[model samples]
Target chain A: MQKVIQFLILRINFIIFLFFEILALILYFSNNPYQGAAFFNSSNAISASMMDFSSNTRHYIELQDVNDKLAKENAKLRFLLSSKIVQNDISNRIKNDTSTIKKFNYIPAKVINNSTDKYKNFITINKGSADSIAVGMGVVCFDGIVGKVKSCSKNYATITSVLHQDMLISSKLKRIGAIGALRWDGNNAQMAKLFYIPRHLEVKKGDTIVSSEHNSVFPEGEMVGRVTSINIKGDENFYTINVRLSTDFNKLSYVYVIKNKFKIEQDSLESLNNLGKNESK
Target chain B: MKANDIVKTALSFMIFVIFHVLIVKYFVIGSVGLCFFYLGFLLTLSLSIPIPLLLLISFLVGFFVDLFYDTPGIHTFASVAIMFLRPKIITLLTPLGGYDEIDEITISSMGVRWFITYTLILLVFHTLIVFLMEASGFSYFHWTLSKVFCTTIFTTFMICSFQYLLFTPKS
Candidate 1:
């Protein structure tokens, strides 16, 4: 007993070091693509407040650019509203029962903190559970789809940016309607890779990619990016294509969090199908 | 350590944490190089600090920085591993006559060559661990290596400049 006690005391430093390393590793692995606990991330109260202060100060320098973009979008929207074709179509459309039902709600929020240099990037926004911003809701800006909300506190939420390594966006060619998955390769902030695009499909540079109906989070036909390059290997079955993301992650300011009213119903119906398959098996 | 020294250490700790989380976090150069100037605090800690205490301090500082960066355990693991290797590296690099009166690791206290060697060795290990863990695998091996190399150089330059500009040599 005495020898064992002496041995343990002699190596206390090593033991403590091991203990902390193990604890830290657990925290690392558990919080990998997304963190389950909100307190450990920037969305927590104190860090979020600090980010809010910094963002408030930095917000003014980019005001001119933000105003320009907003003006352009406003002009486009106004043009659509004033067009005779759109007005005539709207007036002649028959009233359908399903058309009256609201499917999605948008909540405007300001981004307080954002990064694009890391392998996994997250955006912190000012809206959270208090504002009806929940995990898995889609976020979009004026240009294109941004990302999905990953975690939320009472007053703040963290979004998993499209630039994140683990994020896979279900997208399709806007012209040809060929579906593929878009993912960031952890190298460039402005570019991502599209996979599962069959070689037989005709993909060309400048082809637009948009969110497909297959994605549960994002609304259909939301702009994702434009194809920049395509690589076809003799041995590979799928074409390796590169896309230039439409949303400028570096200068993100304002975004809208989308709440799909039918998501719960759709998810439950899908899960029921899976349950039936399992029972038959 | 004296009471005065303890107070100084605490003050510097807060300054390092705040500066790192706020300013240094956004100073990424070309998406390749990142400056982790906060590690300067760990690298210059008084050599007499026990290994256990050093480990604890590094873990806390790393965890705090991680919270702001939203990289939970990545920083903590890297800093802790480097701190554990710190004492051993110091013993291996001990001078011929030994570190007779030197209490802390600084360029003024130790000569430039010794300071560079000590910090370079530790920074390489620190950055290697950080980038590898952040990458999560060998898949991005080449990209990760480039990031590690660039970040170590950037961080070293920042740390050296800060030491020269801030700390005065003892008479």
Candidate 2:
């Protein structure tokens, strides 16, 4: 009887092991990461409290990296609000003399977790649905573009990092004005490639890339990256320019969502124009 | 069966989870982080967490670690595989100096060499799961080789160092 009980206990333990492991596998393949996200969120409150207690009790050298990231973001904010530099204006040369400032609302949130080393990477932010952060909004850390929101529940949203292949940002060279889709080829974390640039447009190494006005997602002239090199060949149809992202992607912490006040109105006009073009066809 | 054992296990698990949250998730240094995150494996192997409980905690720890990193299922697979292999590790590393089954795992009891060997086995086992899952398959031979080499070196050094820190000297 004793031997049978011990065997039954061992088998039960194995069954439990299989159950938890299988649960994890099922989560991996499932379309719903939000389920796991929810579990983490609930546990975070408890874990964070525990860490607050324990981390203080332990010796940690990792604090330096977080400090460095914070310092860079602080420097970036100072530059953004600095009024010393003259605005670069090709158009409205006379109107540029009007010193009146335009006010734009900004939302700030810290990135609790993010990833850039995979074929697909996501970012978990401290802000949530209640914070007015919604789907399709753009996230920017430092002066560079981060990524767009993919999913949002009540208290959190999963942002697809710019490192992911699924991400798309309309970007252009600051000097040449040549526009293309800025994306990653699933290789390096610090590098991305600009595609669809016409050969006629002059692109050179060390040129700056910026978000275009046409992209309602971002304000025009926001710095995206610098053109590290351009691959131009006789056979290729597009000039693929390699970009070195200005913001250190690995150390991202704080970010602000680029919410355009005119997005709703601009989107309606664009849809209307597309509908008319379709009707004529 | 002692109450102290249960408390120790719970405390260790909580520490590993917190380590995942504030440190490993936010800060990364070229996959060197697979080291600190392996604290879960170290915690499991260092003590005699019953095999069933070991697998359960390992799976949760792995899954949670992967979740924070935006990885799907890689952490869970790696952790559970190591958790399953830990009993064999304990037996392999059982002290020739002492015949008694040591309930508590500490450097004072196991010594540095045994600890290193023990950690190396768990790290290799844990790292293999991570490499295989991340590499996906053997289709890209070069990638598989790199991932294997990278994970092995990284986990071995990391797990051993963590063990050294956790075990306080009795003197």
Candidate 3:
């Protein structure tokens, strides 16, 4: 008994070190900040307040850029509104019924913290569950798609930025409707790769990429990026195409959280269809 | 450690943490190189600090850093690892006779060559663990290697410069 006690006492340092090492590893492995609790992340009250203060300080320095972008976006929105009005007038005349259900609600939120340099970058916004912002909701800036809401607290939420390695945006070439998956290559912050587009399809540089209707997270036809380069290997069936992202993640200030009204219903219906197929098989 | 030494260490701990979270966090040299100046606090601690206490302090400091970076355990894991290996490294790099009267590991106290070697070994390990865990795989092997190399150099330069500029040897 005495020998055992002495042995344990002598190796206590190693034992303690092992304990903390294990604890830290557990936290690391379990840290899926996107799906897990928001306590340890920037969405927590204390960190969010610090981020808010820092962002407020930075806001003034970026005022000119923000104003310019907002003005340009305003002109685009005005054009869109004019065309939408014309379509609405024609539809109204064809159908006397006035009921038109709203599909998406945009909740405006200010970005409090953002990073574009890391392998997996995330953005923190100043609105959360309190503002009806929930996980999996699509976030978009005026220029292009931002990301999806990963987790939320009462007053802050973190977004898995488009630069993240694991983030895959379902996108299609606007010119020819060639569908592909857009993902960051973990190197460039402004460029992403479009995969699964077959080599036979006609593709060219400067073609626009937009979000596809296949994903409920983002609305169809949302601008994603423009193709900068394309490579077609002799052996591979798919072309390796590079896209220049439209939204400058470094300058992200304000974004809108999109709430899809029929998301839950659509998901359930598709899941039920899959279940039936499985049972039959 | 003396009471005064403890107070100074604690004060420096706060300064390093705050500086790292606020200023150094944004000071990235290119996309690949990131300087983690918070490790400067652990690196310069009095050589006599016991392993258990050193480990605990590192864990706490790392946790504080992780809270702000939104990366929960990555920093804590790397910090505790370096602190745990610090004593072994000191013993390995001990002079022929011994450390003698040396109290802390700083460029002024340990000389430039010894300090560089010590800092390089520990910083490389620290950067390796951080980047590897961050990438979570060997998929980005080349990029991760470049990042590790650049970040180690960047962090070593930052820590060494801070030590040389700010730390005044005891009279």
Judging by DockQ, tell me the better candidate of 1 and 2: 1
Q: Tens-digit lDDT track for model 1 on B33-96?
A: 9999899889988877788999999999999988987788989998999999989898899889
Per-residue CA lDDT of model 2 for B26-67, tens digit only, reads 544464334445454444443545677678777777766776
Which candidate do you rate higher for lDDT, 1 or 2? 1
Model 2 C-alpha lDDT versus the unseen true structure: 0.70
Error of 3 at B110 (Å): 49
lDDT (C-alpha) at residue A172 in model 2:
87
Q: Give, for candidate 1 chain A, the lowest lDDT window spanning 10 residues.
A: A34-43
Question: Residue A91's C-alpha lDDT in candidate 2?
Answer: 43
Question: Of the pair 2 and 3, which is ahead by lDDT?
Answer: 3
For each candidate, the alpha-carbon lDDT, in order, equals 0.88, 0.70, 0.89
For candidate 1, what's the TM-score of chain A, rounded to 2 decimals? 0.82
For candidate 3, the docking band is: acceptable
Ranking by lDDT: 3, 1, 2
Greater-lDDT candidate between 1 and 3: 3
Off by over 4 Å in 2: A1-104, B1-171
Each prediction's TM-score against the native?
0.54, 0.48, 0.55
Ranking by DockQ: 3, 1, 2
- Tens digits of per-residue lDDT, candidate 2, A69-92, equal 678878876886563344443344
Tens-place lDDT per residue, model 3, B1-171, is 899889979888877778999999998978999989999898888877888999999999999999988888889999999999998898899888787697777788888899989999999999899888787657689999999999989999988888877876556
